[model samples]
Target: MTYPEIKRFHSNMLESITSHASQSPVYQDLETISDIARLSQLPLTTSTQIQNSFDRLGVEKVLLAPIARFWYTSGSTGKPKNVYYGKRDLDDIATGFFQLLYLCGARPWNNAWVVTAAGGETLFGLVVEKYGLDGTISPLAGEMDMIKALRHASRLHKIDIIVTTTWLYLLINKIAKEPKEFERLVETEVKKKVKIPVFSTIVTKYLLRGINYTRLGGSLQNAKIGFSHAEALSPYLAKIREAYPNLEMHDVFGAAEQWVQAIQVSPEKDWLSFFLRYSIPEIAPPEEVIKGKEDRNYRVKGVPWYEWKKGLKGELILTRPNECLPLVRYPTGDLIEVMDPAFSFEVNLERGKMKITLPAIKALGRAADSVDFAGADESGNFLGFKVYSRQVSDALMTIRNVRWWELYHVKGSPGKFVFLIIPENNVSDETAFKDELLRSLVNMFQEFTAAAQARAFLVGGTAAMEDQKNYLELMITRPTAYELIDTEIKQRIKEGRSVGQLKPKRIFVVDSDEALSTLTRKKMEA
Candidate 1:
């Protein structure tokens, strides 16, 4: 774990890495992996799910303690868990860095400043040292709080190279809303003197750095080659190139659990080459177009077709040339669209950080997101109504996949957005959740509907609603409610009509706090 074993890699990179994996007795017992991974068949993987698979397919003492550092995710909505990847996973993935660095024409002496999610021996930091990156690296300044750290590093220290996640860079832009903390942190890091580098991820997407350049001893900024992984790069970062024209921006296609997938030197237009990395990625989106024959649960179609003019982007899947993990064709939750005849897929700009265009435009080019439902504002913020209640539903997706969703009306002193988070599987989970939703529904709309006398029938018949829920409940009660929405959204999409956009209609807007009631009535009346 002292250094990241860096070496050049390319499309055939999988062969060499797996060749190394083949040397391991753990990987040698490949047949046992099926039971180890806990899958009848390899399906899509997110970091959280992979941890479970690792536990089932692996022993903690054998993998975690003996070989490497277990990398965990930020777990934005939940608790964090450590990732267990073997030495082969580390060794092979590093080839990607060597190859991409070679493409950018980098050197060994460059001072490295890693900006990945909390830089430590975590994944990226460990990889950098293994590769003999011969330079100082910066851990994420603290949960996407990188501005002060980067500014201080650039203006003061000696940074030569940079690597970090896309979210951290976006967060740098966000921290500005707090003026004092931003300035104070910058001033503090200045004393540390973390210089700019040739290996910084944030500024690497630059076009020129004549004036916006922070200098140390009057020298030009040093961090030249930048790698943005974890999430996709945004177009906002693209414009930064105007400030640091010499920087090299490479989009790294990999994750914590699985390590490296593919690498693209420039995502400015379309991803160019699929760096021969340790694993050959298979692109497949969830099955929405048709049903899965196995369980009939759901299935995603299409593979990463490198031949098409626009890259065939789907769920990112990987089958190592050596097959590091036990399963075959494990899908990564990331949605991608491949373009250019060469072997590259578009980073999903919709969900994570890599989106280049604005929200309005980002969804247009994509078929992966709520994009198929055109004309609907399937994605975007509805912050205005958020204060009224909790954001239980993804109201942003105008074109939803569920049978229907209700925006419950609440009249309370302390206002809340009573999102009757109905089960997408209400029909399957049966009357319990439906009844629960009904109770919430009654609680939300009872006063308003009763006073207005708009619809007594809707509230009075509780059993009727329960019956409806019973009939439509899904078979697989999704792990989480949000997951149900994600599953159903695609199902509704493939069968439904293809529209330019599908914007959600504001079915009900009840601002019932007495203070706003007068205004609400007026607005509703209008």
Candidate 2:
């Protein structure tokens, strides 16, 4: 699939979709649009729109032959958006997963283990098995502990590759490094009534032995490759590399709306190679939305991926033309940087052919997870800058012991940033940890100031650069376990509902000072 071929395919998909638009309640209004080049004319489809119009199929009855599966987005920021897939959609998703595996050096002789919330239904395991590799799916659904499953699988077979979410992988690596602390954390979770698998005494002993074995020489030690998704991998890459020096790690980017969108082809490369066959890619210019209000209803129009050049940044927009519930010019809300315009990869798979050139991109967290700041220079010229979750994570990763962290930029306090962190259970000296955190933050701000000054020099003049550094006030606090849980998860638990598959939300832009104050007050009370 070359760039031209992708364009042709995209146009054809648009034609097919429009032909049936009259019958589709969700896309009925789009029937008037004839030209594929006029895609930008359509308002960007949002998660809220998708959720609201879920029952209203965008495709005709023939396209919705049968529902293969129901998938939901992580809903980290809002309500979970539901997507219905047909059998072909499922097969396509499986093929996409296989493509990722093939590119990551998977072979027929290798043994792979997939640890995901999807349990036995995980397509990765099935695809690996179909490719004649030993495949195992260990669900983190509370039936069995993840670490236990890893050890059990390793004992039975030589695990060559481990596929799981970034957070799960990090937790596993952290536990391997500090088993005692992990045990204490597990005990705390159990006591807190969190639905985590409780290990029996015998199983606990075995788990300890397994951790010790990994320290020495075990299946995990010998594992050659790893695949991590469901969270940003850039900020945690160094930490993972330090933990598993011998293992090759690949970062996969995808959403429930569309599975396996891109994969990191090289360990040295910071960007992901797009899977053009799965979805058509586009970019909404960064400057248009970087300073926009944090509202889902606000739409951002995008240019085709080919139109965007290297070094440009934007929001990723994807269109899954073949899906039962087709996503047309859907705004993914993920901020991304274009690294290479002519990035190419070639892989020979037993079941499929793969030869394509596509733009490589680096995801810079969600666009909503950013704050725009403005201040006056000494000479009274207005200076503006932005801080994103990616930058924050990059800075926080410098400190090794910080387990989890969240940053808040309240609406009232323009230049103030609040940090809520949960250090590793092993930290004995809070003063030392606080000092290290402050130093890391100072370095981060310095780098930001330097970059801002350079931009000002290029765009304006010396007047723009002089005394442009804003006075940034930082507040740091450690939140208790109760305060650390996400508000939605807490509400769910309070209502006695199942809080399935948790992922960390590290950044927030609170709209009111009262909300921010309440958050801090809860921490204080805790």
Best by lDDT: 2
lDDT of each: 0.39, 0.64
Judged by whole-model lDDT over C-alpha atoms, candidate 1 comes out at: 0.39
- Mark the 10 consecutive residues where model 2 has the least summed lDDT: 492-501
Give the poorly placed runs of model 2, Cα more than 4 Å off: 20-22, 32-36, 55-63, 119-121, 125-129, 143-148, 177-181, 184-217, 285-300, 344-356, 373-384, 411-414, 425-470, 473-501, 510-517, 521-526
Q: What does candidate 1 score in Cα RMSD to the true structure?
A: 17.3
Q: Write the per-residue lDDT of candidate 1 for residues 1-526, one digit (tens) a residue.
A: 0011111232234334334433443444322231212222333323444455456666442232354544555332234455455565556556655655655445666666664334243554555666676544454423223443545444434555566554344333334234445454444444344355433323433312221232421222345676666434443354335433555676665555455555565445425344423444555534532233233234444343232235344445555543233323445445555454333223433255341211010111222222221112221111121111111122221112232343433333222333323333334544555455545444434443343232223654655334322211112123244434434333323322111111122224344445334423322332
Q: Write the per-residue lDDT of candidate 2 for residues 1-526, one digit (tens) a residue.
A: 6678778877777766555433445654664444557776655655655554554544244244567776644465545455667777677766667767777787767877777664334556558545666756665545235555555564545778888766566666666656677666545544455444544444445444553435323566678899887666777877777766778888888776677788887666777887777677788755554322244345556777778788777688886655466777777778888889888766556778676576788877776666655444321222455676777787786577766677876554223466877664545777777778877776877756676678678867897767454434444445354344645444433332212235445666666658877766655445
The list of candidate 1 runs beyond 4 A from truth reads 1-58, 61-66, 74-81, 119-128, 141-158, 165-181, 184-223, 266-268, 288-311, 321-327, 343-526
Give the TM-score comparing model 2 with the true structure, all chains together.
0.78
Best candidate, TM-score-wise?
A: 2
